[model samples]
Target chain A: MMDLVYTPDQEAFRAEVRAWLAAHVPKVPLASFDTAEGFAAHREWERTLASGNWGMVTWPESYGGRGCDLIQWLIFEEEYYRAGAPARVNQNGVFLLGPTLMEYGSEAQKARFLPAMASGEEIWAQGWSEPNAGSDMAAIRCQAIRDGDDYVINGQKIWSTRAVYADWVFGLFRTDPASERHHGLSKILVPLSAQGVTVRPIPQLNGLPGFAEIFFDDVRVSVDNRLGDEGAGWQIAMATAGFERGLMLRSPARFQQASRRLVSLYRQHHGDLMDPAVEDDVLRCYMDAEAYALSTYQTASRLLQGGSIGPEASCNKIFWSELDLRIHDTAMRILGARAEVEPSGSSDQEDLGTWLDGFLFAQSGPIYAGTNEIQRNIIAERVLGMPRR
Target chain B: MNFTYSAEQIEFRDVLHALLQAEVGAERIRARWDTASGRDAALEAQLRDFGLYSLMFPESLDGLGLSVIDCALLAEVCGRAALPEPAVETMMVASPLLVDVLDRGLGNGSVQAVIEGVMSGDARVAVSHAINPHVNFVEDAHWVIAGVADAIYLLPRDKVEVTPLKSVDPSRRIAKIDFDPEEQYRLAEGEAAAAVLRSTLNRGALSVAAQLVGLSEVLVEQSVRYASDREQFGRAIGVNQAIKHHLADVAVQIEYARPVIARAAYTLSVSPERADIAVSHAKLAAARVGLLAARHGIQVHGAMGYTWECNVHIWSKRIWALVREWGDEGFHKNRLQQWLLQSNALLGPEFTFGRRSLLPDSRVSDPVSADTAA
Candidate 1:
């Protein structure tokens, strides 16, 4: 009744995943998928992976996946990170929207989007937060007016990751002219190639166009693009958000890989560094990552028993985001002055410069996928059943 | 792989929780605080009759043949209720050692009497591990189980000279025991003794971890209840973002720790060889959350938590005591580091559940995946 042993099939699957990744994972790490060249390179890698049917292992085989369970997906991720495989440029499509579509989209929509999503033929940018709708997502005011067979969308989406090189965007828009807040909104899938769509790249702290501002000027997308029914966008978006904030987007193995690297970073410096605090920090990172991994497995186990991820997703979001911050923060502290040194050409620079890049990027962990403050409030009100203001 | 409790495990836990709820409330726990022994005879007897002490013994001895996994949640229940008993050692720690010794044909005459007495609700046994010098509830114990250097003994309580100590937790009757790990009382020696001692220490840590997790829940629950009822800034403090956030953080820690503790119990039951590492993880996580629960629990209570009259202090103080006992922070942290520092330490998400297989090594060839020798 209580067991933690992975089945022989699962072990074989992990071995197969490891072996394939070892053989096919790029010898030279692909560039950050934010730039155009990097984007195309990552897309090529995804195509290579898709050729091996390694695109989104949890999805059905018809959609270019192995139709694996969550455990297998976790194993796939473990090997993926271990292999230092290129980041999936189509994360927004495969990780976030793909699951949402499977849950809420029509059969036609699934057939239309999933294979391309998994194959990285169409990279997606999430249109979640706006200038006014950052933490308060219910403050969404973007309009998508219904006209005959098309919904002409207008207004802007800010902080859209990958929108700079993305081919499509999935967003929430106000359908009813009189509608306010989260009500009367619909989730619409739109192509960046649409006539009136404008993608303006936003340079991040590291001076990269990792983000973008998407402006839709009366862009007409077919009614068939709307996921679920009109006015049901909030519920559908929340489910997508549950996937975003929970296991799918930021898997535990990602942090574990980071933590392992952090530990390696410490071991290299453990001799010269007299700071026991660094050792403590490294230990905390390792243990916290393990705890997070164990927690995900527990959630997956429960989910396998037909349980849904509830408000506990907020807790997971907060845990991993903050953990990501701690890991990079510790690496920076361990590196000290040399942390900022971009020793790019040298092999020594790989670990050093990678830590610096990760440190810069880790700042966004607490901000994106819903802020930690907002997550804490959700945990309080929903999970703890506390009184809300 | 299933990570769930059986119907038997759940039912036994529920019944024990029900009985503890009915018999050993905060008031009952408070009642024992005034006495140095911290024993409620009526409640202890009821607990024994309800299959608490005899839970881990063999079925042939008129006891439930339950392992640590089945009995683990009961430790948590006892913790949640702040049950002032040495039930942890009697059940999770000493019981297994007693069974092991019995299997070696060592429980003869007096040892056999002690075993039968403990099972049949007539006697209580407290244990003293080498890692923890202070024995809790020694005055109330009929026999003392002591593990030292290379031998373990089941000595009569009267044989050990006990020195009373100033207790931190009001419900704990703390003492340092001077037990002779002599021949007549010795249960097992040499490798047999070391093996039992190692596992028993892990069991102690795991049981305490379960209790700490449960203790943390009480602190959060009490604070949440108080925050909702208490008004501040013209509304219930529970509505304040500050209060909610504090409790929420504690709740998050609890959510993570609960599964780790359960996993530790599973490890102890299924793979005792790996229990040290697993149990240390459980211990470290529980201790962290337990301490966090106290810090936030007190802050959320304001002046009330600082007061002795408040029940929050009762649970908080118990958390403080439990955290320092059963392989403290440094002990467990060092244990984990030692295991993790090994070159062959199979880490990553895949090895989290499964043991090291005979599968030929791959992936460790990756620089980051390669383990550094410590």
Candidate 2:
């Protein structure tokens, strides 16, 4: 167990990433973009990361990737956020799409797509959740009928994050509509640049087009674009979701940092008018964050030691997501009416506004990446040996 | 980072538990407490004959030479039995340092006598509060290993006047001691004396904390069992959220206290540099949580648990006594804050461990020093 202890080399690796991020992350007076400009700047930031060979960490070096260990990738992320690096524009690619491509994409497909994907030349967006298939992906009605050597896809995917600015779309399509619910699906990689594909942005309560709806009309893609075997789309999509559960999504240290920030903010705003109960709540948040960090570290150690991410990963996800919501909520409570006040000027205004943005975004944490309800159900049914209804 | 016990440690704990259960079972524990020495003489003799009493001493001193972790494991079983014995006073205090002090102060004659006495179970020594400056229980002891602000006071049982005091736990004796100031033995003095006493006292406190953790485990486990087995309104009381959640809270306390106690014991055994903070944390955490388990054990067991006929009161009183023994929660927390301020401010980031949210609903318990010390 103590073998999880880091050696000097790991510390040196952390230092190296810290120094690199501090030097390369732009200090430009860039606005917190909520529109197309934000997307452009975010894309530019991804390019900057690519230039530093820090993009697609843990991906093969042959595909413009570093081929670093997961620990190294985590270290890079830690420093990236510590240095206040710009938002990762290709979150869909790096988190959801890239790993799937590496796992199920053919050699020709990898050779064709991995480099551009890593270099931030082409951004990918998820086209999985549709109007009727939000939580029920197998209920998807999107059809991809095979014609000659090409598959003609015609369907509408909704709540597709970043599809409005995406260069390509990757998702599951029911290639055999008459087949069984899950057996009918096939994972397809479709180019959003196709003349028949149309994208429309959906404005969220946060006033950002963080999501979009994409309509496919006779879009054509070669059979080679299908990941894995036919009717294996459910397996491929599950693998992507599994990756999202593990290394691709939030890091526990990230939550730890946020919890610390909440503590510091609480300290900053201490006054007689403030409710003293907030103090205990803030401390509770810190404890939750710490426990979650320890749990995640244990998970990372297990993975490093060649262990599979088991049902415990679900526990870690449920823990950290709930912790994230609590910490952000605490920050909102601490900010009080200022959270409601729009920023007129100054960085303090921007910082408070950004926290408010995070507060708004954090509401979806339990709903996304396998809802906490689903997670608890898994824990009760699979891990805790409860009888399933 | 390794939080597991070695196989030897596990075997040792198992054997010790069996020995304790057979010798000083709960049935005999109360009667032993009513005795003069507050322990079972036959059990003590057997443990001594088995080399258990010599754990903290070196081989050169005719001891088993075990680590503090070994002592902690043994103490835990003693805690579970609520067995009032001088094993802690001797192993934690007298054997480790007093023997050497005796050797130095009164030459080899006194040293040899005390060592043989401890080994043979004939000579029972206790720490007196004369040294503590606030409390004294030396009169209740055959030999009072006492210390003062500037001197070591070896107040023999014959010298100090003793008066029995009302105690929260009748199983252990507590007394007010009046000592002759000029009769100080002065075994070790000044900074060296202070350092030795602090180290010894801290080790004792750590041992007590570990034992309290063990006792809390018993209380919580038994309460949980009772809750599961006892039915109320056609279902086990455990089904009631109030009862299960209380038991769960006690479970949380045990979980949180275990690591702090382990860390404190480990620090005392391996690296003394970190002992102060580790012991304070351990004492504070254990005492606070132990008190909760004690109180909740009663509530969980209801009216039957509050009576002397039930063993719940036995565990509760023992927990209460031990909580206020060395340094209660308030004193230890103050000490921790003091140490935090006075110590070299290194990279000590204040990250709360275990479950901090549970603190709001739990009451912190005080530490109980045996009659010997304040």
Candidate 3:
């Protein structure tokens, strides 16, 4: 019937979530999650969310989730961002790895890791993308040799987001020494405090170690930590990447919230900005945000009806990343000199500092999550069915 | 609630897609553009026989009684072929408007007969909207539903003046309209007239947006197909990152725009009061994406695209004309800004899907809620 409205129970759930967030969300914004103190503070917030079973709404209740549908998850997000909740410090664990675990992990694996991940007790970082394998993830060189029911890993992973402060990392490691490319890859989880592991922070332009570099030297992990079939790491990692790019990692609510703030910013400066071009750009932010949200709803509904997200995730990735750029860029135009100021942390609408920080971070959107160039290639060959020259 | 189209809607869109591809050739669409007669009588009769004109006729009028949701997707298929018959305007806007006027007891015996004729494929209606400042397809219309000075009326084509104007899109036979005002045919006045006008405008805007989206789809799809077949530098042109990336960007715009258009159509049908911004957003997204596809579609096609030899312009040209019709970009932008800039306006993620989701204090007992509770 193409009904786009929420149901009564869905609305009821939203009410519960809104009231909870309103009551508990920090009155003052927490520091950026990139810093050690901020990382700890945000984790505390995650604990608060977990206390109310709002950690991961769609995950089963046994795993500390409320056992809600995707619709409720979207509503929770809408309210989360609307209420100005702190940024999630465990995005890699909850958004990407958690969903993958649900799909491919053993029951025992779920019981051991899901609760901690939900409660923010153990934050996880991704260990994909070695020094040599940025967009070409299949070219990973890290190896984890299986020995007596234990895998000893030795290699380096760069661009390991949150590795500087995280408790663990789950990444792709080559298991078969003789095999090449994607064939020998195995998905394994390793503790950061394990022996022979060194973490080096890579300061971004913001002078924060938002991501890190990990050097693995004889780090030992039980073979029981492996997910799915041994040779199927490429497949499993790809499924996770699909989740990252398509649905979970970058929900449209985030951008919708940003655009709403952008509209307020634009309206605040409407008298000085009569330039039709600037006006059009502001309108585009709103339109793009709405368009993204609607597309997600369409996707969510289709998924609920048993359709899996596929290469269309490539389109979604490109849309949101570019949209993020447009939104922050437009905010910069509206902010003028205010855009360059450090965080005043006054309010979200007037938060020129966050916009400035976002402007810098949004540049990584096209580069990370499989560079926009590679995404366009995927869309061409896979989604649009064009030939590879 | 679900957002995907129902099975019946999909079937209708697919059937129209096949029929338009087979029957409405490029030459037929170009018929009105050339010195040949502006109307395709035979094709018009065939579309009427297909019951295209009666799609929105109320069931009491012995019709399928469909809304914009069932037909707008098919409009996208029609846009792919650049259908020149004004079927979207007649079926979506005019038919619904007629049903509204009649249901309000404003229509006389002749208007009833016209609606009956529409249901029987014996009549086609053209709308002379006040927002448009002109009439379209008057050469082929059996009647005109004209809005003027906060009043509505029914007028015959002969009684109204339709001065044909050359349009950027050759297929759109636009004209300045002048009709005699008669009290006998007045449908409604004041707020009732405004209500009817508002409904027609949203539906018409949605129709145009659907067509624009349709054109955008064909442009991207055809460009991809062309780039795949055409070779350059010893390989398929689509092999180059430049070409693939351009087409991919257009595809992204189209992907996101479809849902916006769908939501607009749904809002218009289920919640008309809330449809203004939805339709505006839909048109804005559609026009922007449509233009992107047009520019990039031609760029990928090379010199052949620039020439008359390529049919890309057929889709591209209509995008230019239709984008300006039924409220252009500036009009929609202004509308959105008006609502957003209001001092009390609530702009955030909570307001995106309307305030229904955020208003938890207000409760309603419905079957779906009961099921979820159980």
Candidate 4:
């Protein structure tokens, strides 16, 4: 009955997660995954997590998960972030596509991809936005023409996150040439190493290839690689996009961790940098993180009680994307001149530039997973029942 | 942890929503704006008859003995209706304070009579905490629970001189109360009085927060309705992206504020030790968002928002009055800052609603952990 108090079993589960994370979390932070060595290091960390069956706890046990409910997953995430663990390099696979596959994938498809995804054997990238279809995702002109039991794909996808080092990509491609907009689209899974596929790393503000531009020149994949049915790509992609925008992709723990760091940073410098305005901003980041966490818990509870995610996901997306930007911005403000100095190495104590790097990445939050503007439109029209133009 | 209300709670909320909608019409509240008392006696009587006044009192006192969450649920509805009865202050603040005073054996016959009068709908109570400069709706209240220094006094309204103070919200009648501290009846003093005052202030802040959330929702609803019906450039203004985005921001603010208020209410009922942080969070979030909603509501309605005829100012003014009622943004933020600096609490994902003691052994490095530990 609207119980915010955790049960004894849940508390016990939380204690277990805390103990495990304390023992296993790296004492030193890992390098940024923009570099190949850092990417490999992150992969190894994922393998360590998989060995503990903690890579994706909400997934079914058959896929190396504990089959825990969303609340337990939230608890695990809280501990995972609290312990100062490395970021999930395979978030694209595990948080976004993994849930989508569990929902719409066939038994064989789940058997093939889920284990690899859970084990970090095959990292994934999202290939949603094209040069023209940034916010208007349905305007994607990428085509996957049918050729017997295979589809010959040809398109250029921009802003494909983690594509340079990822093994596979999942995206939407127009299957029927005559159809327009969202109609007759298909979600095709393509291996990054397939013939006629080219990945050009796009250096972000951090001078790292965090995302890439993928050129597909008649890259053929079997028809079985398609998720859901043909002509239903838009719907399936919407579901995946919902998952990406909603609870799974950006868990509250991530923001909470950042908020904690921000608080610590504030405490470290409040003597010299103690402005009421700055103090208020710091408190705002903390409170917003808590609010987001509480809201997510409410959403998870509702879903467990047989509720489905709807346009309210749009509200969540807008709140969190903006909140992510604000939290990092507050941190950078606290860092002042130190924010400009890039870290010489992962162990550089004087390098406060990770906050700067984080700020740069947060700038993309509102622009990705459907821009915050688009999300507001969805909320206004769908959730609030306002009129559409 | 379950974050959803039970079916019974949902039903209670729905029923309260319907009752407020049917009973407390906007015209009824608007009518009180010009009255001297700035209260609708009929509506107050109706609410008391509906058993809202006794929702927080002990069952032995013939109350519903509901949790703070329940009181908050009702407070939101009252805010939505712009209900002008001090129902929130009376039920959520005063009654709870009085109940505690009696339970602590600090209250005498006069306090008991006032409590009985409150349950029977014969008396109306208004609280004037030190945080608030004026006692709200003092003219309509029979008993005024005023906090002076470290002690609390229960005084009959006739024993004090209340000078009327104009509020931005015309329906919210406020006054500066003056009385002889020695002549009034002392309810409690020392630690007992301090505890009662603390609980009263927390509940008062939480009530206003919940009400502000309700007021924000109403503002959003009104703005959306006006945007939909008021056409500009050959279409509804709501179809315009600018208008839609403004309203959507308001909606998001309201959406996030709800859970904070709920969690605060739950914490107040279940864990008093955590009530300060929780209520401060709730108050700051709701007041900030409520003010934003008020500004946006006026902007969305254009010039019509400024006029009395549009009805937007009714809720807008109430939001202005309520934001500073129990605790303003600065007040709550300062409280949170003090707590943060003093305790060095484990500020992280794991400790959002949890105690600092919940942190693992490796993380307890703060000097204040011994005192702050749950």
Candidate 5:
């Protein structure tokens, strides 16, 4: 039974997920459009999953999920990658806020928001990463004043993913000006339809409106919309960030997909007879992917047996992020001349434009989700027990 | 799953560290390097009494049943002190296979006698081969384990001739042992002994790699301290971008290589099948880092580094010799390429493709919680 560590039941689950994905995944041709209609199509794909009750596979059934273990979720992700499902458009809500709400939301808040959230009826966006508070999130200047029954929020959140399309913005605002850093912070869920709120989409390198800059001017949110206590925002936001950094957001299935695409591209273009340096880099990418996959599997297995994540998760995050960059760089090297220009329109080629796009996207990996340098500092000081410099 | 050291391994490391601190400090190491025999017999006996000698062989064959990882921890301490002892050469090389043969009565009692002799501080053994240029003081060995044909050329001193050559490192000497075909108790000729010997050689390289890591670590620490304290003009030399960046680069190299060495050692101890690829990668990474670290250690020391008074030369020379031994960077890289070609046959094309596709988007999201974070 323990030959390859998977059981017949797990295999059966994989088949079931594969079959479901085959039947439901949309076959509409995509042209890499930047219009609202294209994004709407992506959102509709997410809604399809929600309608089928396949959204948030690991969340509680009450929140419109299957309430499955990590293994089943992993299987579902594998199938999702295999079936080439359109990437999730509401990642901020489905991956981050949805999990945070499940953990820390009030009974009233859960009953009010979770159903719509799970059904993709409302889209959510993160309000972290201010202009000056990229890696140092605690230095955010966004402030909130406690009124009689509501908190008036006034600040700007830059690099807010999908904020232009999102119906809700979950953010951290300083509730106590007298208190020091990270103290007196409160997490508030504000409806984007409120007065004095505007979201302008930020142009990314791939010419996609991948993120936005949100301006909140005296936006009033009911105190009941707070995810946790006023001062507990830092901790609750940390939970969301952890999910952002961990398996919930960055699954092994994604890496598996990337590795597969790279190998195909290498074979197609380089045909295994590329420059020795390129071959070495490709080999290194494979090794790093395998190591990361094995390490993550161990982490997931521990979580399945009810073990808490440790500082080593930072190590895992840094490794995969750096590795992701290396693999995409190798793909660019393979693509050679064509890797420079952006793809005009989506050709049927497997990885020509995709690799270039991914290469561009990988540039931000080390900066977002906490910089690689910070992660290294965490690994050195926290995991390896080295003294902080 | 079991990441932390076992209680016994922890205790073993603590005792070994204490012993190394007391008996193999810089002054003692320098004295041993100057001595005719490059070893301290009394201290060697003390280590044997602490069960360090029994670590490599199996418990059934009079060993301590310790893994290569345990031996690696000891190697780190020994390397830091530049201790001139055959701890690694003896344990990693001779103890496992040679002792196994001696215990099984397949080899001469002379092999077993040398083992008992080392345990009692009465005799020493060192290996030499033209194929590998890292052998130290092979002529001085009472017994030499040389590779001739498919079997170990176990030559006694009476049957072989030795011609000593001056080595750059003071802690070790080199000599070619001309093995005479007329004398030897046994030769186990088969793939079994060859496989075991190959594994032993890889483990030996990995042990040295661990030692090199320790040596590089000390070099970085010493260089940083010197940079901080050694002032020139109005500021410390460390304030200079050249000096500071040099030390920082050494540090980064150490970080890149040390984990590979540790992982290789772990593979040798637990999974023999993966040891080939693991050791190749470990050797390639370590050789590059060890050379850079050792050379930079001297460069950071300036004029004083060129002198015999400083112990940096001893560690640097050892790093060079050990890295070049077994398989150097180029040799290991080629080996890795070969291994990859072979392994490609077993893995499906989809496996590699899947890895590439999945790896780029791979993210291990940090779970939210102080308990999880810390």
Candidate 6:
């Protein structure tokens, strides 16, 4: 029977997750991961979650996960966000690369990377966008020449999230010098502390070095680090991008929590913010959040029935990114003049800084994980079968 | 929680689609647009034969005894074809109201006769809820289920004065129905009437929302087909980025609107307490997206979209007509606002479908009564 109600076992699983999260989630929010201390704190939080086998619940039991299905993963996320747990610092590994590795990684690669990744011992950063290849990712000029027993890579990867403190980074590099566009690239895993590697922190709009630029000066790694075939980087990166844009990353629970906060804010200030227009905007944010959640549940249900995620990932990406921005924008609007003034006291500073930080971060959503424009083109050409220019 | 439709639901939709494809077409809708009655009796009989009218009625009453979700699926297909019938108002709204009236022993012989006549395809019912300003398709209806304040009345078409009103959609025959309280047959009054009226409006909104979703799909499909075939500047217009992006935006809107409608239908059937939020969410999204699809469909069709010959206008007009049918955006927004501001209801991802009990500081004592409040 096709049912929306959770099964008995799934309900029990949700109860277990809720109980664990309630007891363990930090009372005070952790600092931004841009600083070394804050990054280490997030890493410690990830390790604590892993100790309870809650690091990556969807991975197989052998990989330190419970081997739960997507539905259970969604339930876990709902509980996690509801409990106000610290953000997943190892998201790049657990959300983006972890699923791709499961799909395309060789047995040796899986055995070597999955356990450490599940345990948050080896945090990962994405190395996709470069100074020249932000939207046109296939135009990457980074090259990794084949050596006797290793591939010597020489490239500069910019906008690499968590590269300043992450242990390893996975990215696409040109393998076949003679090929062009999307054909000659290869996905390779490289350690940030490898010889000939230098990382420079780049401050974001919020004055945080949450992302960095990685320069590879003739870095050499064994052929075992290459995933799949030598010149199949585009396809592999796309699979990873699908996971990043699809169900795993940006779970609906995150926005739901934001919407709930927005509602709470509205309720607290209803006497002052009594305009029907403001009320309508607040309701819209709540509606869009609920709509996105329902849509994602439908997608999760479909995927659990052995269905594959298609260009709908582009659709999901566009919907949620815009939704996040709209919700934050409404929050700022609700704050009104208070939005303009910086907090004067310690408690007020922390309380007000959360919304300010959120507003700044939401701006990056459309730019990262493939720009919304690029996503629209993909939807137009690939999903809708429109003629490509 | 599962969100996909069951195999049976999919099969039911497929059957209705096949029937609509075979019987209802643009040409049929266009033909009916010029007629005085603005209805295709044969098509209505065919749909009735398919058990669409009996979908939400009790099985003991010789009906199919299906839920609102099943009725919503059929209504969507009807909207897709622009079937020019009151399937949504009759099957989804009026039939269930009739059943509730009968179940409560509030129905009289007149109401029973009308229900039998509607179930047997011999009569049609037009509902006039307090929320809707005018009664729709009353000229073609034999019975009018009119709501006045806290009571409901079963008024025969002859007993009421229906002042014909022109609608943007030519196929829709709407009117302001005025009946004397003494002359009409009272079906239910007081709290029971209020409950029935609320249920009627929610189902009405859900049906219209589903129809708007279907119409949105039709607009997108029609525009895509036109763009693919109509060439300009030495190539198909769809190849251009401007046209492609416009259609793509419409597609995205339709993509999100669909699940909202489905979820609303589910909430109506399973969680009546949360029906206001779910239905308003569905109606708001569907109306917004449906209007977007209509505007883009016309823009993509260029000058032809405004003409009577182009099939896009038929569905486009229906979109405009249905946007304000059950409840306008402002009305539903107010309903949601009350829930958010007054009820202190839990608002989060886990509570999307009304898991209020799960909240840590949940105010269980003051459960949201927005449905009744609205």
Give me the TM-scores of chain B across the candidates.
0.93, 0.85, 0.92, 0.94, 0.84, 0.94
The deviation in Å at residue B12 for candidate 2 is 9.2
Candidate 2 residue-wise lDDT, A261-327, digit = tens: 7766775676536765666566556545544544444445557666667555556566667777888
Candidate 6 CAPRI grade: medium
- Residue B123, candidate 5: alpha-carbon lDDT: 64
Q: Quote the positional error of residue A286 for candidate 2 in Å.
A: 3.6
- CAPRI class of candidate 1: medium
Cα deviation of B371 in candidate 4 (Å)?
Answer: 8.2
lDDT of 1 by residue, B123-188 (tens): 788888889979888876888888887888888889999998877887888899896556888788
- The digit string of per-residue lDDT tens for model 6 on A320-368 reads 8988998888878888767765434478566566777788899999888
Model 1 CA deviation exceeding 4 Å by range: A243-245, B104-108, B358-374
Error of 4 at A339 (Å): 1.6
lDDT at position B259, candidate 3: 88
True contacts kept of each: 0.61, 0.07, 0.86, 0.75, 0.00, 0.63
Q: What are the DockQ scores of the candidates, in order?
A: 0.63, 0.10, 0.67, 0.68, 0.09, 0.62
Please state the error at residue A294 of candidate 2 in Å: 3.3
Cα displacement (angstroms), candidate 5, residue B301, comes to 7.0
Give the winner by DockQ: 2 or 3.
3
Q: Give the TM-score of candidate 2.
A: 0.66
Could you give candidate 4's per-residue lDDT for residues A333-382 as a string of tens digits?
A: 77777777776665564447678777888998888888889989998888
What is candidate 5's lDDT per residue for A69-159, written digit by digit as tens?
A: 7767766777787678887777778888887888899888988888788777888888888998887889888888899998888889999
**After TM-score superposition, what is the CA distance of residue B217 in candidate 3 from its true location, in Å?**
0.9
State every prediction's TM-score relative to the real structure: 0.96, 0.66, 0.95, 0.96, 0.79, 0.96
Which stretches of candidate 6 lie above 4 Å from their native place? Answer: A273-276, A341-345, B356-374
* Quality of model 1 by C-alpha lDDT: 0.83
Report the C-alpha lDDT of model 2 over B36-86, residue by residue, as the tens digit. 656555777788876777777777777787777777777888788777675
